[model samples]
Target: MQLKEFSFICPVIESAVVLKAIETVTSPDAIAQTLGNTDSVEERKRKLPSQLVVCLIIAMSLWSSDSMGTVLKNLVNGLSRQWTKLGQYWKVPNSLSISAARQRVGCRVMSQLFERVVRPLATEETPGAFLGELRVYYSYR
Candidate 1:
């Protein structure tokens, strides 16, 4: 029998690609506004600032099957240099810290983020987006 190296590519979307697409749709100003509106902005800088947490929450959704730590790592790893200012002492937070940061931000931040950025992709004439004369929406709640 011949031996060959085994390799498999993950089906999960790359963090950089998704983050770029998301950033394009949701501007930094929009994110800041949402965080401010929800009163979830951090008072002091930390490893996971409120802005970073907001992005982390968004990245979490894209990588649902991944652990929070993994999602966070992927997000930080994918960010551009300007997004972070650490030299070399920073490290990925443990699961508990990530959870704490998320809790501090709370549900309102996520809700506000959605409200500020989410918009209907279909227009009145788009097929299948409407049912008869009414517009159809996918309700998660």
Candidate 2:
């Protein structure tokens, strides 16, 4: 069949349901609430803001393709754009900077952020149908 002859549009009902589900999963308030409780002070120096760092960590997690090197590379490529958008308050760390940040904050912070933000986002029932598919495909195997 020719490309033009085939229907390309998704059904409106499915699309609306899917979109609403996605919105619930990625809601900003959910993100803020999840990251809000992170400790803000360490060794008497201010740490990166929990909310901002959580945002960065989430982006990094999404970009990572199964390796630390890949995550660093993706962070470098998108760093400038993200920094520009987030303003001076958000610093895009270099390779060394990432190493330092990781050392300073440790893995616990990132792990907590993931559990708080990404986990809930994945589990919200409105979004569960799509996430169920992903879990079956990626997690169950």
**Per-residue lDDT value at 90 in model 2:** 44
lDDT of 2: 0.43
Over 17-121, each residue of candidate 1 has an lDDT whose tens digit, in order, gives 676765666667787888888888888878888878888888888788889988877777777655555557778889899999989999988887888777776
Q: What tens digits encode model 2's per-residue C-alpha lDDT throughout 1-141? A: 212232226433233233233234444455445444455324443334333344445555444443544554343344434222344454444566555555655566656545654542233354443654564223421
TM-score per candidate: 0.76, 0.38
Candidate 2 lDDT trough over 10 residues, lowest sum:
1-10
RMSD of 1: 9.0
- Looking at model 1, the pairs that clash are none
Q: Candidate 2 regions off by >4 Å?
A: 1-50, 65-92, 118-141
The Cα local distance difference test for each model comes to: 0.75, 0.43
